[model samples]
Target: MKILVTGANGYLGQGIVEELSQKSNVEVIATGRKVDRINVDVKKIPVDLFEVKDPYNYFGRPDVLLHLAWRDGFIHNSPAHIDDLPKHYSFLKK
Candidate 1:
């Protein structure tokens, strides 16, 4: 099965992608703003999720999508989180 994982370069994302990539039946598609930081041996795509028109097709029509991408996650009251709400919604809508 093909699985598309966004935020694949982040701390949690990296571990998830690494674990998923080890599965023999799983085809992992790792996506992030900086995919070079991802250490897993899988398909890597550098993408700005907020700007992608069609995420499903853009990331290669995967059977599943694990949307872990977020900005300013450590900042509890970051304005970026609020600013990106609409973008995140739009990305998920498609």
Candidate 2:
């Protein structure tokens, strides 16, 4: 099974990637703004969720897409947080 995980460099994302790596049947595609943070033996693609014009073209269609990447992470009620809403919608619509 092919799984595409966004924000693969984040705290929870890192753990998720590590756990998924142990599965023999899974092929992971780890994506984030910075690719160097991911040390797993998986396909790494640098993707800033809000900036990607065509996500499908960059990463292709995966069996499962784990959308964990977020802008202004963990910062509630901030301007950056508000800015993320539209981006999220755009991501889903695309």
Candidate 3:
């Protein structure tokens, strides 16, 4: 299956991608706000989630998406400032 993994440049994200990539018949698409400096075999992409209406559209019809991103910090980190988690998740669930 084609897996679109967000925050794939982060520590946890990178690890997941690395481990999953070695398995046969699995395609890993890694995306983050910024690219990882280190070299890796997985597909890498840079995207800002907030700017996207439907974030998954960027993946070109992914079969699955491993959500590894959360908007955090004092800058913008609350339900009041962002979309409802359940609703946002539901949107992606489609």
- Name the top lDDT candidate: 1
Rank order by lDDT, top first? Answer: 1, 2, 3
RMSD of each candidate relative to the true structure = 1.0, 1.6, 3.9
lDDT of 3 by residue, 1-94 (tens): 8988877777677788888888888888888787674256878878776556666676777888888765552346476336546544664665
Superposition TM-score, candidate 1 onto the true structure: 0.93
Candidates' C-alpha lDDT: 0.89, 0.82, 0.72
Model 1: pairs clashing at backbone N, Cα or C within 3 Å: none
Best prediction by TM-score = 1
* Residue 92 C-alpha lDDT in model 3: 67
Predicted candidate 1, C-alpha RMSD? 1.0
Poorest stretch of ten by lDDT in candidate 1: 67-76
**Candidate 1 residues 1-94, lDDT tens each?**
9999988898889999999989999999999888987887999999798778788888778999898888877678999889999988898889
TM-scores, each model vs. reference: 0.93, 0.86, 0.71
